[model samples]
Target: MSGAVQAKGGSRHGDPNRLGHGEVPASERGPASKRIVVSYGFWIFLLSDFVMFSGFFAAYAVLVGNTAGGPSGRELFDLPLVAAETAFLLLSSFSCGMAGIAAAARNAFWFQVAMAVTALLGAAFLALELYEFVHLIGEGAGPDRSAFLSAFFALVGCHGLHVVLGLLWLTTMMAQVWAKGFREDILRRITCSALFWHALDIIWVALFTIVYLLGSGAGA
Candidate 1:
């Protein structure tokens, strides 16, 4: 009887069903570690991307005046169109934020919808940008015609490439969510992509201000 009692006592003291001392349950581990890893990885990527943009910016600063006495920023830039493009991109960032909120809430349907809306807004912004480029080129202002035009095209085109790549990344994330049903990995990737997209939008705002606004007044 004493042995059986001791066994019972041991079971209570060393309960297999209980959490071990100073141990965390898997569910309670939280996403902090994952967030840190992801944030670090994204920062590295952003740094690399910024390096590429810096090269383009330097090239533009050097060649912005080789306009061959042709149209310059003041003559080419339509402030109204640029303003509209900025609005679309800013709104797209807002939509991406909404999608992130939905993902955090585990609301799959709303997350998909928000992502779709963000993509549409991004597409609209791209369309406007492409139209601006084409219009400039059509007026004998092609990049090959002048160093100024080449630099302008290269800087703006590189930015547009990023936008296009971001849209592709966004689309892939949406598809992954549909296939995986909000798995932790998918959510993390989506969060990273959202950060990247929003960062691009912010960078574009600065570029637009510098290239179109300040540069427009350079030779005036």
Candidate 2:
């Protein structure tokens, strides 16, 4: 009878939620460790990227009015073109989120479709930005034209470069999904991609508001 009571007490003490001496909860053990580590590391990377962007934002804010007698943002910025670029990027982020959902559900067809749409939207955004840059340079308002132009190019071009990199990353993820299916590793990569794409949309929104809208005298 005493042994039976002791066994019952031990069982209760070993409850999955109960962490005794040197015991780990099931929620924090095994495969969960890998997922937690990967996500935490990725978040650190994103935070570092944000810090870099902060420096660019500060530089642009300081130099925006130093146009050296060249055409100002009010004269050069095309609101309609910028609005289109913003739309494409924002929509791509939505589709990328859908792709992540499809990946989690292991729906290969929907995942591929959503990813394809996202890639196309991202490409369209890059194309529009390239056109804007070409038009500016053709008008002799290139980065070398003035301090304001230099800061504008540095900020916007940095973002454009990131978009190009994101497109490449998206293409790689598609290839990985096609080859590996919705395995754990593939899903993790998809999650990271979703986070990255959404972060870019947020940054672009800030850029649009501060650099484009305000610079164009919309808020002035």
Q: After superposition, which runs of candidate 1 have C-alpha atoms over 4 Å from their true positions?
A: 1-35
- Tens digits of per-residue lDDT for model 2, 1-220: 9999998787777675655523556666657567889999999999999999999999999998898988999999999999999999999998998998888889999999999999999999999999999999999999999998999999999999998989999989999989888889878888988899899999999999999999899335
What local lDDT does model 2 show for residue 99? 93
| Best model number under lDDT | 2
The model with the greatest TM-score is 2
Per-residue lDDT, model 2, residue 18, is 59
- In model 2, pairs of residues that clash are none
lDDT of 2 at 207: 100
Q: What number of clashing residue pairs does each candidate have, in the order they appear? A: 0, 0
For model 1 the TM-score comes to 0.82
Error of 1 at 198 (Å): 0.9
